[model samples]
Target: MSQDHDEALVRMVNQIAANLGPGREEADAAEGVCTHLEKFWARAMKRRIVACLDAPDGGLAPLARRGVERLAERQAD
Candidate 1:
């Protein structure tokens, strides 16, 4: 994906993490974000975001990173 697309995915991941993170434990919040991505995001979107996990400057928030990690694991399964 282009840099712009990757950046957009990073922003969206961060926003989703923020939206799902409040009033919950970190792990739970991450799980919520993961679930949202799995259920709502397109396969290509998920793949791109998961790829961001490996990017040196993906810019995903900590929670977003965790959620992406979870999503990656689920995807691999």
Candidate 2:
């Protein structure tokens, strides 16, 4: 995806995490975001985010990073 597209995806994921995170623990919110993404996002989208996980400047929010990690772990199973 283009850089703008990637940034938009990151922002969207962060927004989901923020929306789900209110009044909840950070870890719980991240898990919720991960679950939501896994169920709703396209496989290619997930793959793209996973690819960003290791980038030096992935630009992922803390919760977004955790969500990506959770998603990756689930995919590994």
Which has the greatest TM-score? 1
Misplaced by over 4 Å in model 1 are: none
How much is 31 displaced in model 1, in angstroms?
0.3
Predicted structure 1: clash tally: 0
lDDT of each: 0.94, 0.88
TM per prediction: 0.96, 0.90
Q: In candidate 2, what are the lDDT values of residues 1-77, reduced to their tens digit?
A: 79788888888888888788889998899899999999999998998888788889988888889989999999889
lDDT of 2: 0.88
Question: What is residue 35's positional error in candidate 1, in angstroms?
Answer: 0.2
How much does candidate 2 score in TM-score?
0.90
